[model samples]
Target chain A: MKDNVKLMKGNEAIAMAAIRYGCDGYFGYPITPQSEVLETLEAQMPWETTGMVVLQAESEVASINMVYGGAATGKAVMTSSSSPGVSLMQEGISYLAASELPALIVNVMRGGPGLGTIHPSQSDYFQATKGGGHGDYHLIVLAPSTVQEMADFVSLGFDLAFKYRTPSMILADGVVGQMMEKVVLPEQRPRRTEEEIRRQCPWAVTGKDHGRTKRNIVTSLELDSAVMEKNNERFQRTYREIEKNEVRYEARYTEDADYLVVAFGSIARICMKAIEDARKEGVKVGLIRPITLWPFPYDAIREAAKNVKGILCVEINAGQMIEDVRLAVSDSVPVRHFGRMGGIVPNPNEILDALRRDFIDKPANAKED
Target chain B: MTREEIIRPENKVYSRPRLIDDNYMHYCPGCSHGVVHKLVAEVIEEMGLEEKAIGIAPVGCSVFAYNYIDCDWIEAAHGRAPALATAASRLNPDKVVFTYQGDGDLAAIGSAETIHACTRGENIVIIMINNGIYGMTGGQMSPCTILGAKTATSPYGRRSDLNGFPLKVSNVVALLDGTCYVTRQAVHTVQAVRKAKNALKKAFKNAIEKKGTSFVEVVGTCSSGWKLTPEKSNKWMEENMFVNYPLGDIKDTAAGLEEKTVEVKKS
Candidate 1:
C-alpha cells in the first residue's frame, strides 16, 4: 500500500481527509462516537503542516457559530458532533442555510429522542433529509456506508457545498465512525489564496474591497416581508436544481428479484448480506442503498418497485426513512418497516428473518406461485 | 468672520467620518447608537482599517448596524457575535474584527460566548452598548436592567426578590486573564464622547496589535424605552444608570503587549 493508504477508523479518516482536502479551519466540540474526529486532528497537528486551524470550542453552539463566521470569509470550514450536540447546532445551521454560506457538518448518529445510547443508529434520517432546523431550507446530505466513503466524502461534500453555496452534511452512524477499515486518502490540496477566495466568493464578507467593490454584508435578517419571500424563492429554486441533478444510489440484484430492501449508511451494508442470505433461501431480495439521502433516490426506488412484490425498509431507527420509501413506491407495492432501536444494531440473520416474516411468509405480501 | 467664511474648509473643526454611509440612521433622535456608530466609523477611518475591517452586528436595535457602517459586516444570531468574531479574526489575522452588541445581547443571551471568548483571549474588539433595557423588544427587562427600574416585563418596580442587580459585564471581563483592555465609558456629553472615542481607539489599536480581547462598554440610553425626552434621557442615565455602571477604565494590560499561543503536541 502507498503512504496515503492506511488502516484507520472512519472518524480518523474524516480528520485525515479534511487536512488533505485543504480545509482552512475546523471548530468543533467533543462528543461520543465522534470525539476521535477532533482527537485525530489534534494528534496530526495539521496546523504545523497545512496551517489548518483546529480549536476545541466551548460548546456545539459556539462551534456552529464559529463555522458560520468562518464560512462568511469564503474559506472551507466545518464542525462535527453526535446527535444531541447536533441538535444544539440547529439554529446556527438554519442561519448558515439562510445566509447561503458554504460549510460542512458531520453527524455521527446515535439513538436519541434525548441523551440516548452512544451506539450506532440511523434515527436522524428524518432530521437530515427533512429540514432539521426552522425555515424552508435543505442541507446537501451524503450518507457514507464505508470508511473509504468517509474519507472520500470530505472533498465531495465540500465540492457540493461550494457549488450550491449551501451547507452539506455527511450523515454517518456510530458503526462507520468507530469501525476500523483500510482506506486510501486523497493527496494534499493547497488552501485557496485570499485572492482566489475573493474571486470565487464575490458575495463573501472578506472585508471591504477598499472602494473598488461594494461592501458585502452577510445576514439573514430581512424585515421586508416581500424581500424575505423572494429570498425563500431563490432558496427553493436552488433546492429544485439540486434535486434535479444530484440523486445518487447503488442497486444490487434488482433485475430478477421479487422483494426489495431500502436502506442507507451502514444499515445498507448489513442489508447487502441479508439479501444474499435471503436469495439462497429462494426469497429473491434486492437492495437499493441511497448514497445521497436528501436528493433521495426516489426515482430509483420507484423503478425497482415495479419489479418487486413488496419492499422492506430496514434501518437502525423505528420507521423514519420508511415514510420516504412508501412515498416513492405509493400503492403500487406494499411497503413495511423493520428495525431495532435504542442502539441495538440488527444483524444479517435478524434482517433475513425480518425479510422472511414481512414478505416471504406473509400471504398478502408474497407473490403468486 | 462672515457666515460663508465661517463655513469654509479652513475654518471647519469637525467632519463626519467618511466610512459612515449616507443612509438615514434608524436610531431615534436622542439614541446613543447613532453617536457611538459615528465614533466607531471615525476610529476605523482614522486607524486606516476600513479596508481590512469586518464587523459582527448583533440582534438588537443596532441589528441594522451594517447599514450605517460601510464595512464588511456579518449579522450573528442573538448573543453569538463573540463566537463569530473569534473565527473571523483567527482565520483572517490581517483583518480587523469587532462586534457591536446591546445589553440583552452581550450580558443576557450571549454571556457564555462573551465570557469564553474573553477567557480564550481571542484577539477582537467587543463594543457593548449597556442600555439597561431590551430596547429592540420595546423596553423589556434585560440582564443589565437596574434594581427598581420598571420595564415592560417589570411593570412594577424591579425588586431584589424577583430580579437581580445589573450585570457589570465589563468589570467581570476585566478580571479575566484573557482580556487586555476592559473599560466602561458613556456617550452622553462632549467630554464623555471624546473619552469614549479614545477608549474605542485604544481598543482597536490593541486588537490590531494582537494584544488580546478588548471590551468597551458604552453606558447608553433609549429615550423611547425610558419614556423620557432625549435631554431627560441623558440626565436620567447620569443620575440612575451611572450609579451602577460608572465610567472610566477598569483594566488595561495592553502595555505588556503579551501574545499567548497554545502549542499543540504532535504525536
Candidate 2:
C-alpha cells in the first residue's frame, strides 16, 4: 500500500500501467488467456479520465495496423494478443519495423503451433526473436516474469521503442498473464506534450503541414537495392548499440555456483525457486535470468558460464531459448536444455530434479577438468 | 485588377500544382496515376491543406505516391492503408487524412480493412484507382477483374465459375450507413478529368468536415497491363469497366441525397 500497491494479475497490471504511463491509444482483439487485457481496459474506460483511446478492433491485423498508424504520429500506442493473435499481427509488426515507427505490443503467449491450448506456453520465443514476418527487422523484446515487472516494463519498453524508433514487444507467457500477485503500479505519467513530441520525434507525420519543415514520409519501400541495403545497415548498427548498452538480466548465486541455469520469463522465476531448492540439498546452482530476450544478455550468460561446470537451459517450450544460450556459451562449457512443451508448465521440483540428473547422477567431465 | 488588363490570351490555362514534386513518376506513359496525382496535389494546394493534409499510400503501383504528393505521408503495407488512415484521422481530427489505393489493394487483399474503415465511419478520404486487373504485379487477375477478362493468371480468360463475380466495392461501400459519399469517376477525357478532380475535391472536403468516410473510385486504364495502346486502354475502360462500375455519385449523405440521416448502426 506504500505506492498504490494492489493485488493484480500480470495482464491487468499491463493494462493499468499502460494507462498510467500515458499511453495515447490501445487497439486489440479478444483472444484466449490475454482477453483480460481488453476487458480491463474497457472496464476502466481510461478515456474519461486520461483521454486514452481504446478500441476493440475488428481483427488482430486491423489492431496492429492501427498501432502502425498511431505510431506514425509519434503517439504512445500499443496492442495486446496471445500466440495466435500475435501470429496474425506479424505483417503489421514487420511494417512497423520497416517504417521505423515506435509501438508497444504485448504477447500474453498461449500454447501454439495452431491454437494448441488456452494455457500458458513459451512456444513463441523463436517467433518473437527471429524475424516473424517477411523482412530484415527485429523488435525490442522484453520478458516480464512478475506482475510487478508486467507493470514496470510497459514504460521501459516504450522508452526503448522511442529511443530507437522501433517496435517493442513485452513477451509474457500465460502463467505470468493469469497469475495474481501484489504490484505497486507506477505513478501516472502525463502524455507527451505536442512540443515534446515534435522535438522528440521529428520523423512523425503530425501534419504540421506543407512548407513547415521537411515532409515526414514514413515508409519502408526502397526500390533501389543500394538504398534499402543502407537502411538495413543503419538498423543493424542500432541493434549493435542496443546490445552494447541495453542487455538486461538478473544474476543470482552465479559467483560460487558449480552449475548455471539460463532461463527467461515465467520459467526464470521457476528456475530461481529451483536454484533455492537445489541449494537446500547442498547443490551450488545459480540462475542467469534474461529480461531482454532480443539483444539477449549473452555477455552475462558467458560471464556466468565461466564459473559453472555446465549450464542448463530451462524453458516452457522445447528448447527455444537454449539456442541463444548455446550461442552465448559457444561450446566452452556444456549447455544442456530441459523444457516442457505444449502448455504444461514444469514445476520447481521438476526443474531441481533436472539439475540433479544433469549434475549429481553423472559426475561427468566438468568443462574445467 | 480589371479583367481586360489582367486577362491575356498567352496566360496559361493550367499550371502544375506546387505540391507536385519535380521527380519523374515511374508509371507508364498515359497511366491514370499521373493525372490522379496532379488532381490530388491541386486539391491540397487549392484548399490550403498543404499544412494539414496527411496521405496514406497503399502498397501497389501507387506505393510511391508519397514521392509526388509533397505532404506528410505514411506508406502502409499491402491492403492496410484504410486502417492506417483511420488512426491518423482519428488522432488528428483537425487534419485531412486520405488513402490512395488500387483495386487489388482495396478490393482484393485489403477488402476487410477497407470495408471496416468505411463501416466505422472513419473520417478519411479513399481514392481507389480501379483498373480491373493487378497492374504492378504483371497483370494478375484481381477481385474486380471482369468476367472473361484475360490476364496473365487467366490465360484462357476469366471464367465465371473459376474466378467468381467481379466486385463493385464502391457500390458495396455506398450501401454502408457510415459512408458519407461514394462516387465512381474516370479521367480519360478533359471533361472526365474535371469531373474526377471534382469528386476528389468533395472527398477531401468531407474528411475535413468529419462527414464520415468518402470513397471515390477512379475508373482507370492500365495500358501496359491491358496489352493495349494508351488510347485503346481508355476505350476499353469506357466500353468495359464503366459498364460494371458506372460513373457519378451513387450515395451522398453530406448533400442530403438520402432521406435517412446518420444510421449509427455498423454493418
* Candidate number of the best lDDT: 1
Candidate 1: residue A264 lDDT (0-100): 92
DockQ of each: 0.81, 0.67
**What is the C-alpha lDDT profile of model 1 across B186-261, one tens digit per residue?**
9999999999999999999999999889999999999999989999999999999999988998888845444455
DockQ of candidate 1 (2 decimals):
0.81
> Of the candidates shown, which would achieve the greatest DockQ relative to the real structure?
1
Task: State the displacement of the C-alpha of residue B2, model 1, in Å, after optimal TM-score superposition.
Answer: 7.0
For candidate 2, chain B by itself scores a TM value of 0.92
lDDT of each structure? 0.93, 0.90
Per-residue lDDT of candidate 2, residues A1-369 (tens digit): 486898999999999999999999999999989999999999999989888888888899999999999899889999999999999999999989888889999999988789799989988999999879887888889999999999999999999999988899999999999999999999988988777888898888988543466688999889899999999999888888888888899999999999999988898888988899888888899999999999898888988899787899998888898999999989898778898887999999998888877766676764433
Which regions in candidate 2 have their CA more than 4 angstroms from the true location?
A1-3, A208-211, A365-369, B1-10, B256-267
Worst lDDT 10-window in candidate 1 chain A? A360-369
Error of 1 at B94 (Å): 0.6
Candidate 2, B133-172: lDDT as tens digits: 8989899999999988899999888898888999999989
